[model samples]
Target chain A: MKHAVSHIIPNLTTLTASQTLFDMVPLFREIYAFRDLLWILVGKNIKIRYKRSALGFLWTFLNPVFMIIIYSIFLKILLSFDARDPLFLQRLVTGILVWQFLAMCVGDSLHAVLGNASLVKKTSFPRIILPLSTVLANFVNFAITLPILVVFLFVNGTTLGDMWLLPLVIASQFALCLGVSLILSCMNVFFRDTEHLMSAVMLAWFFLSPIIYPFSKIPEAFQRLALLNPMCGIVTAYRTAFLGTDLMAPRLVVISLLMSWLILALGVSLFQRWQVNFGDKL
Target chain B: MTTPAPIIDVRNVSKRFSLQQQRGETTIKAIVVDALRGHGKRRDFWALRDVNVAVQQGETVGIIGSNGAGKSTLLSLISQTSQPTSGTITTRGKVSSLLELGAGFHPDLTGRENVFLYGAIMGLSHRQMAERFDQIVAFAELAEWIDEPVKHYSSGMYVRLAFSVAVEVDPDILIIDEVLAVGDASFQRKCIARIDAFKQAGKTLLVVSHDLNTVHTISDQLILMEKGQIIATGDPDAVVAQYQWLSRETACTAETKEWGTGAVKIKAARFLDAEGQEAEELQRGMPVRIEIGYEASRRIDAPVFGFSIQTTSGILVYGNNTQIEEFDLPFIEGKGTITLDFSALELLAGAYLFSFSVHSQDHQTNYHRLDNGHPITVRSERRYEGVCHMPVRWSVGKGK
Candidate 1:
């Protein structure tokens, strides 16, 4: 019976099945083949974010500026600090803008896979592109807001010191955000509670990163502990770029770069390990 | 002469899903409870088991089954949207599947933008998509509205654009799952014509549908699946015949149901072919004989006997009575048999319910009636649109 049926059918393709976990080579190849799709997803995300709003892309600029004004007003009344000082204001605004990029990227990444459940179930592509596009969309927003930082520097009568270092800092920050996004997006696919858990984690992460206060405010004994937070080096580097200050030491930059790369490695491996379960689980 | 190789080969493939008792339990409390339960609350479900299939180039294969028969699971496996738990599936060339319409479409994006986006998802380069953009829009017949957001398009228009892009991607093997049922009748005709052209171009096609007529018309071979196994595979008519029999046997057993005075009870009814052997299945345009065994408790004068054939959906396809034909039986008593024969059954490919009854000569009272009589299946090699064939032909001539 089987032979009769087999004769009626034809054979033009061949496949072999095996369980392959932690196989990075094929994963990379698949992602590379789907690179165009990654870009299109990123474009869709960014377009949909600002498509309907009246202010549109203006929100990317107004968001950081409004946060700076609010924080400065509250601090001026409560702390009796010199909020009028141009140097202090410049550092504050630049730090918040950079921190906004990181927070928004990680925050959106948490829901990346869950939000595209329909697409995930219908088509097969590199699962990492969903989270990766979230990060890239926020990066485009950050790029759009960079001119605001430049305007702030000029208004404050400050010069960009070691301007070439800005690209390196942005690249490091992008890697760090991409890494965290990859891990959190995969976790959120399996666990609905991850969305709530992430908000609390980001709240704590914001305070630990020294975005509001300068790095020098920490006591010498606690400076080493604060440096362990990767964002410490990142925020400080932004401040150094704007104010031409010597706060971002060489050792701190190295630590942050190494930490970002390590996290990225871990995130990619974990993403590949969990991606096979996505279609079944989702 | 050497035989050419098949385009798709699947062997002994099976898929198992681990279903959790409590879905999406990611809280700390749930995790702790699950760990303590030692994974005992989870169950394994095998959607497919040791199924194998192969299709050569240019062959259009149709898969048919009722719901939950593992049709979708098998398609997903072949399309590589999901991996099987065991065995191997290998295919040559690119595989594009329209598992669902507008699956990757963003509602806020314009139809034009979604064309590029969907193309990329299907593994087309930006330049390649741009070159085919006009052709895709034209095929969908949405040239004027291509720039409008897809959310504004009607559901039919949305599906048209999605289907257009899927077929335009130039895939070597196309897998479609119940997507041809979308769009208006005219558009459906156009889509069928396009697919026919695609088949002529020597691309392998795999389709899963519940519409038996569509399957019968398009497929070179048919596969009938039940409970995660291919029960029958071969000629479309034969497989459909098997499917009809299996479904009828499972759903309605004990086909004989009678309610009358028991004066003239129909003991049994059987359908036979030309050779006179009992046959429940017969082909279209073939002769059929229905033998009715009856036992009468009392003699009846001028008894009228007849039969009615209704499609499975209860639409009466054919009916005849002795009184209607001006023929009468003198009497019927004790055990006896009557036979009705059709020189050639013009019924289409479907299952039909046969009912036999004996009434008064004046056609007022039914002495005995068998409402749920024998169910017979008719298989056809040619496609017929409606319930029964009307026996028509066409000729072309110049109009003046």
Candidate 2:
């Protein structure tokens, strides 16, 4: 009977691809199984990122801090933009911190596979770990910049109204970054054009996000469209929850969170499917 | 112990590839025209065709073939790197292939970091890789450089680390294709020892190599392929003998050489055994006779009758002339025949080139020559090996 059954299955030669969602369980288990590899890969990228550089980890903090200062000057002095509430610059800095995380994740994640094409073509590990590791490494960079967000709050003499929700917001943004990065990284393998196209798109995405300007500055007609940008909701929520800004819309946050989860699940499945056959194409 | 079922069964598997050759398509116009007319299209190439083999658990098999003979393609199919274009190959147990070392290495990552990354890629868990990490570094002999980025490693060091990581993973079914040719001799010896140990532990191995000695040492069975088809398969010694015979019989015809005509013309040539029976099969350490017939348009004196036998790498194994034998023979006019009788051919199993030549004895200049004469196949008849199987005496340790 065993011999008979073995002859019946076609393509059984290929480790028999999983047809059901439960199949993802083993894949996830496999990813978890290689957690040290995941952590070490993330750690290695972090180490090599600053290796041989003078500023080292200080550069991580300087990037967002410098951007916040530049944008603060541009908005307060050049554009003469100020909220009647008197905490305008603090709110803008909050948005920039979140935006920096989003930008870095998008920027590095697109080349996650191409940059390590050697690893992609040679090893049979879960390919998602690559983009996941990039996101994880970027998280470390984001963590160093978080202190600045708190400094902005302290300087503004703001109260932490619902600041306890900051971790949840950060987690949501991470999920959203991973979901989008996964899709882009997979696509990057087939179309190298995605790498260049991504940078241009992200620049436009930044302006559309409420990072540089205030949400109140936008016409209400376009407010809904602005909220649709995933990072806009996260950044706005961070400003509201932490610095006591009133820009948060719970409805938009919920929508983006749900969309993030949906994209994450879909992206994971697509990346897994494409990964199994990558050795052939790569 | 109960006999194991054939854990690896490959049946009637074929892999076909589509090769595209486009001409004069600088602009979009050519592509549009070709797409419209459906002409000047891609061609189908069969890298492996209708191959069938089964290995019981704990078997060691060697796959030998010339370049583009589809050796790598066959191993790739078995390893599932690429799906077979047709038929089936079913294997049970974890499959690991070392098609090329350092294939997935990240240059920017340190050796230690690459170990984990490479481990995960090869499907090993963190704990598993961690447990073996020290041993891997020790085996690769890169202890001091483990923390340095892999980009800084020399070519030999890279292969050493890559190979160490691969072998340490311990998958059930291992497929290797020409990956052992790197590193120094000591490392190669260490690798061969590890493979032997793996076999002793009852692992299944499929090895593809041009190093016939290593293949012969490690493999219990063999398969020979040519032009995408399986030509022979069986016990290691028998299959190798047959492959060498096939290689030689077709040496003139085997597609290994492209024939050309210059001045003197080779009429007919064939290989024969000592009994004068025309045969392609030559036994190692046995006399091999090569006979050739050639027609010269003009008279030639003291012609340096020579033949050169070469390997696929174009490495000359041996070349000599009849003048060295001190025989003075005169070539009259039209046609003549020459026969070379050897006391014994000591070459291990390999394809060798044979050619007939008539050079100016005084000047040693090429007059009229057939560089690749009729092909002569030589193979090992004895179980002993090395570049040449030398006659030796041995003494075994005493037993009570």
Best by DockQ: 1
Clashing pairs in 2: A118-B104, A124-B121, A125-B121, B250-B254, B355-B373
lDDT of 1 by residue, B62-157 (tens): 998877788988888887667788888888666777775654676778899888977777677798899999899999999999999988999899
Error of 1 at B49 (Å): 1.4
lDDT minimum window of 10 residues, candidate 2 chain A: A4-13
Q: Interface Cα RMSD for candidate 1?
A: 6.8
List fnat, each candidate. 0.48, 0.28
What's the i-RMS of each model? Answer: 6.8, 7.4
Worst 10 residues of 1 chain B by lDDT: B247-256
Top candidate, metric lDDT: 1
Worst 10 residues of 2 chain B by lDDT: B19-28
Looking at candidate 1, what is the lDDT of residue A25?
81
Docking class of 1: acceptable
